[model samples]
Target: MAVSKKRDKNVYKAPRNIGKPESENPKWLIPTALTMLIVGVVWIVIYYITQANYPLPIANWNIVVGFVFLGTGMVLLTRWK
Candidate 1:
């Protein structure tokens, strides 16, 4: 019986972005900004509606929904990369 030699496997390497110029960065700021803006507007609207309907003395827990949206939008805006 004849023995066959095995070929060496090639290693793959990830491309480096370390030296990439500023121009190569993605231009997602505009779209992200717009999304955040829309979210904020909706949040405010929801907040106002909730405040007006739930109670007069502000003892309701429904305002949390509005705040959740607002906080999420703010976090997205701040953490946009």
Candidate 2:
């Protein structure tokens, strides 16, 4: 058998950037998002577990806080890519 020596006709250029740009994402972004999501769930669970008057002693506002954290985490997750 003989080996071929022809080169592929593609322009070869070395990558100029050392690493990914900041616009891509940070190492902590996903973790932070996950934390927010988990914390949000825990916060809501505590509120419910305590009858919504043991943790913060506030009524009806517990749901709002949980939703806000969850929403923020979801938004952050969307920006991860």
Candidate 3:
């Protein structure tokens, strides 16, 4: 007669092939994302320091532009492997 043991119902077992190779990010990914982030920060900083007079004559709209750059950079970073 063969005897078998059952697995614990509450325990979790990971698969053998769990460690897949990491995917490589595109050559432009890092630089572009970093640039966007830096540019966004600088844009906002300048806008504040200049009392909303520089970067763009649009005043409050400059904040929107800066945030857009920041958002784009963040989104790009999420795709990195």
Candidate 4:
């Protein structure tokens, strides 16, 4: 015959955040994200249109800047809500 051990009732349990309202996003989030996406697209477009002769003295840097802006905006947007 084998004896079974009883379960412990005092085990620590994390609280469930049920019935909690969803948090609202910051007011600036949407606009800023949109602006960055737009700017990135526009920068690429302008670079192609001008044959990489406009925006900045260095042709390659323009693209880099545009991508940085886009990345930043995306990161900010993810934090929203």
State which candidate has the highest lDDT.
3
What's each prediction's TM-score? 0.35, 0.67, 0.75, 0.69
Please give the TM-score that candidate 2 achieves against the real structure: 0.67
* Candidate 1 lDDT tens digits, 1-81: 999988768867677976666463247754766675676567556557776564333444445555655566676566444
Assess candidate 3 and give its lDDT: 0.94
User: Model 3 off-target regions past 4 Å?
Assistant: 1-22
Q: Number of backbone collisions per candidate, in order?
A: 0, 0, 0, 0
> If ranked by lDDT, best first, what sequence of candidates would result?
3, 2, 4, 1
Residue clash pairs of candidate 2? none
Model 4 C-alpha lDDT per residue in residues 6-72, reported as the tens digit of each score: 9999999877876665787879889989899889888878887899987776868989988988898
What candidate 1 gets wrong by more than 4 Å, as runs, is: 1-59
TM-score of 4: 0.69
Q: What is the C-alpha local distance difference test score of each model? A: 0.60, 0.87, 0.94, 0.85
| Global lDDT of model 1 | 0.60
TM-score (C-alpha, index-matched) for candidate 1: 0.35
Clashing pairs in 1: none
What RMSD does model 1 have? 9.0
Q: Candidate 4: minimum summed lDDT over ten consecutive residues — where? A: 17-26
Full-model lDDT, candidate 4: 0.85
